[model samples]
Target: MIFQLGCSHGLPGIFACLEGAAAIHFQDFNAEVLQCLTIPNVNSNVPSFQRPALQVTKCDAGMEIHFFAGDWREIHKLLPYAQNIDVSTGKGLDAQYDIILMAETVYSISAVAHLYELIKMCITPSHGVVYMAAKKHYFGVSGGTRRFLSIVEKDGVLASSMVAEVGDGSSNVREDQTLSLFFLFLFFNLLPCGCGHQFGHLPLIWRIKYCNRN
Candidate 1:
């Protein structure tokens, strides 16, 4: 299962869908964004004939597509897999995501902690991995890759590695970093985020994973 948090246009989630992920969930802060942009973008890429009814949870391929919109603090209540987690400990009861992807989602310091907590609830406790693409710093907001990593490092459950970095003469450097596992090429192709950094197509990438998976 794959989950893309704070998905604006949901490009990464769409890529996972095209890759034949058994399930892909796209989330955003606004329902309108999902209706006007995310859904349309997905449908444009996935043929109409191939799409199962949105109400249908699963199909022959074990494929499921879901979209959600709400604040990070409370949205987990509505997420199917998140319902399986023990919220107090941020561990799973029955269901959790194998892969979680987010881009430019760490720009607000106030929201970063909530986002991290939500990740803990949704990801598989033992071996789930996360792919995060963001700038090293967000300047005025004081939220960025390093800020988010500080929280992760303090927790000591997940470990991160720099997968790819982009300079391109830009003062603010951005990186595609991960927690653990897998080799895959990410073709981002000039997607610009709110922080003013544009990610170009990247090469083979490594990710971050749980440190004490047993």
Candidate 2:
């Protein structure tokens, strides 16, 4: 199962999941917005124009598209009724999803800790993966991402294992004159909190691996 968080506009990630025929759990902060997506529409079309077009094209095709709309802070409410099972057993109805994909959702510092907690709760101990993508500018805004990182590190949930080294001997280079050529170093470490932080200057993607020994 795949969970798509903050799926606005349903771009690359959504389309990719569709291509793979994966079972998707789409989420957003607005119920009205999610309703609008049910009516298949392309990015180029105006909102009003796309709704009718989608109704005519795909609504009758029996496509079982799932959508969740609500504030990210209230994800429990946003989840489908069937998906929310007995909390007493410590697992939701859809426990242990194979992957969780978050896009453009980490820019809010206030939401980072909660997001990490949710991810940890939803994934199983064995083979789950969480992928997140965010722009460098987001981290610079009040250092929200950095602060979250610090909190995770302070809690001993993650260790800053490595930092990328770039410049003179780096292998990444671009031929475009307009683009500055820079070397990128990658970091591989365990995030004790189940979430890792990456910055704009960092060329490497940091990862958190579950440590079963402890």
Candidate 3:
């Protein structure tokens, strides 16, 4: 399972599909971008075969391909199989994604909170992880991984570990540390909704905290 947030050209999401992710959801801020650039790119790139177009639906049967164009805050409701994660309680959703990938999306300080919350909503609970790549700072934007992580810290819902940093004295993009990954675990409620799903035997369960609330 994979969620490609802010999938501009949809390259990363398409790559996931080519890599045979059971399901891949591509999201961006504009629908036109998807239709003009992303979809065409996908149509051209998917492994060409004599067969017809593959059917992608909500189930895990075939390679599920979904597209969404909108702000992160409102898009999750329309996202297939999006678990209703309660950020406050650190609980919700019967299932979660195996991997979440994003690149160069942390440039907006105002949107980082919504982006991180959405990640929590879409990611699988215990073993799920997010891999992000961005510069140490986005010049003139006053936004970067450092600013975004501060939001995560204040929320006390997720954890982060630095993955890599690259810098050479002479390069114009000096100290533009490459990427980071947040491997998070939380004990939150997984409630049953009208979808005929049922909760655990207990109406509520206190999940084991994932090591940090500091």
Q: Which candidate ranks first by TM-score, i.e. highest?
A: 1
Best to worst by lDDT, what's the order?
A: 1, 3, 2
lDDT of 3 by residue, 1-214 (tens): 8777887666656666666777777788888776766566666655541122222444333676777788987878777657566656644474467667676677888888888778777776777766665655678878777788777778777777554443444332212121222211110112112122221111111111123432
Pick the lDDT winner. Answer: 1
* Residue pairs with backbone overlap in model 1: 178-208, 179-207, 179-208, 179-209, 180-207, 180-208, 180-209
lDDT of each: 0.71, 0.43, 0.58
Please, what are the lDDT tens digits per residue for candidate 1 over residues 1-214? 9988887777777667766888888889988887767776676664331442333345455678888889998988888878776756675565579999887888899999999888887888766888888877788999988888899889886777787775667467776785232223333633322233334534323355676763
Q: Between candidates 1 and 2, name the one with more favorable TM-score.
A: 1
> What does candidate 1 score in Cα RMSD to the true structure?
4.5
For all predicted structures, in order, the TM-scores are: 0.82, 0.55, 0.72
Residue 144, candidate 3: how far off, in angstroms? 0.5
Stretches of model 1 off by over 4 angstroms after superposition: 49-62, 179-187, 190-206
Candidate 3 TM-score, true structure as reference: 0.72
| Model 3 ranges with Cα > 4 A deviation | 48-61, 90-92, 168-214
Model 3 alpha-carbon miss at residue 16, Å: 1.6
